[model samples]
Target: MPVAPAPPAAPAYADPQGSLRASDADRDRIADILAEALAEGRLDAEEHAERVEAVYRAKTVGELEPIVRDLPAAPGRTAAAPRPEPVPAAYGPEDVEGNADQLLAVFSSTTRKGRWRVARRTNAFAVFGNIEIDLTEAIFAQPLTTINATSIFGNIEVRVPENISLRGTGTGILGNFEVTSLEGVDPQAPLVVVNGYALCGNVEARPKRGKWVVDLQSKIRKHLGH
Candidate 1:
């Protein structure tokens, strides 16, 4: 029999968070990085524009890696050896982690949404109650945040905006633990890891909508200098 070829190793820059989404700010940061590279003669103008367009269209960090993989880091930065895999740190220095926060609901319902600062580590609990966490307008303390949640005879729900990445590894024992956003992730985007257990209850994660409208409104306000 002929020898079978070994499978290729996975790219290291591949988004470990899985199908998480990207954000406008994430895209802008990459664009800035590309712009800097262009000014520094690391990338030609054509390549820079092309990469910027792709950056805007990119829904995840995985899509943004190849654009600058071959370019050298800024003048002051130490360049690491090149590999066949993608490198998350090569993108820039803005993707740092944040502090820690917590949320809990016991025999009642607790909801957190709107614009708020998220810690690097967040602990959420729902015991005979309900808990909802929405990150549509959240400001993360770090580029990657971990959410540890537990639901017992209650419900725990997480709502994230599009383009942000989510890795949900929660398990359910005689209950339900579901993660709806697990496709087309970006390694450079903010990573939110959802982990925990649900007992006789439900734990779910999914994406939100209407961010474009918000973006448009912000642009209009800025255009008018309001």
Candidate 2:
């Protein structure tokens, strides 16, 4: 007798507010779940990559439900969990440490941003080019991070989270070395040190701010005069 394959497992729970927006942290959590599944032999490399990509592409909590439906829940967490607040997009640098340690821009431009792991010490070089290092959406692999930069006839702009602590010192020979003053910054936060030289170029660092997103609830609230 021909028998059909068993049906896929059902979701643990119903998604009540499926339309609710998702956050970076939520996506990261889903990715973590997928990674564990891959490590446990439940998913292959190709499947894991595809699922991880879907996680980043997801726009709402409901969209993430199916990808991890058959996988085990994360430790200390449930299979059907509420989305947490967004966190800086960063991952552990254990595997990538000592790999791709430098960002060089030669007569061109380079950028690093969005859910990336930054090494403990990184070098940013720009020669007649532009280099942008956006750590606002990045994760630091260590508690202390040092970015050594060198810009000659080029520009280097770095953006960090507003709550993180910062310490920097550099020289600009016929160029500019400008960093935002740290006021009301958290003292216990991770330390980021930037030191380098800029010749006929610009090196600037500033805080990152959130961009507004329009949602259905916001529109409803406006109509209701809330």
Candidate 3:
């Protein structure tokens, strides 16, 4: 029957293993490698940030291969030698006193701005109201701060500094939950994790324009000097 229309050519990949789908653990491994590369001066801040961002966006194993092809072999893989641990950066005091752990807004707008201390975990609830959390000038008392936001027919907005990493694992049901994942240059920068749900409402976390953690390294140095 017309020579069976000839057999279709098979798709190909540089490495057969690359054709596999990448799991969350695979992405995490790659991120760790990039962090190590950044710490070891193998890759600059921009490169590290870009690669890390790509790592999160990668869908298939093939997509992750090129990201770390030039870098040293990842852990558990064949390598000439083992990699060394990076020195930890000094952090400022984690002032948890007087920090608000729960923010509720019902039919009114609630805003948390200016200089303040961020607790290890904060919950924001907006029921038929609005809640705003700005961290550009806020102090982080922990390396990892989690924000649990719930919006029921309302809105919750979170603004973060540009020098800190941001992550979101929220969902939306007949609503919108959006968070732009960002990887900051400083490896020691605090990580802000947003996790919650939006029910017929909206929740968003993003970097405020022209806002950054002023002199992060200098602040760390000053903290160490004390």
Most lDDT-accurate candidate = 3
Candidate 1 lDDT over 36-147, as tens digits, reads 5644456664565456557656777667655566666432345786523323321223334433467889999999988777765678889999999998787654445567
Error of 3 at 111 (Å): 0.5
| Tens-digit per-residue lDDT, 1-226, candidate 3 | 3655778667674546666888755765676567667666788766766776677668898788788878886533576787554444433465435243899999999999998878766889999999999999987765656688999999999999988888777789999999988877777777676878999999999999899888678766765575
Off by more than 4 A, model 2: 1-100, 183-187, 211-226
Cα RMSD of all models vs. native, in order, equals: 13.4, 17.0, 10.5
Q: lDDT of each model, Cα atoms only? A: 0.64, 0.67, 0.78
TM values, all candidates = 0.52, 0.50, 0.60
Winner on TM-score (2 vs 3): 3
- lDDT of model 3, residue 14: 50
Candidate 1 stretches with Cα past 4 Å from truth are 1-99, 183-187, 212-226
Collision pairs in model 2: 90-139
Q: 89, model 1: CA deviation in Å?
A: 12
What TM-score does prediction 3 earn?
Answer: 0.60
Q: Number of clashing pairs, model 3?
A: 0
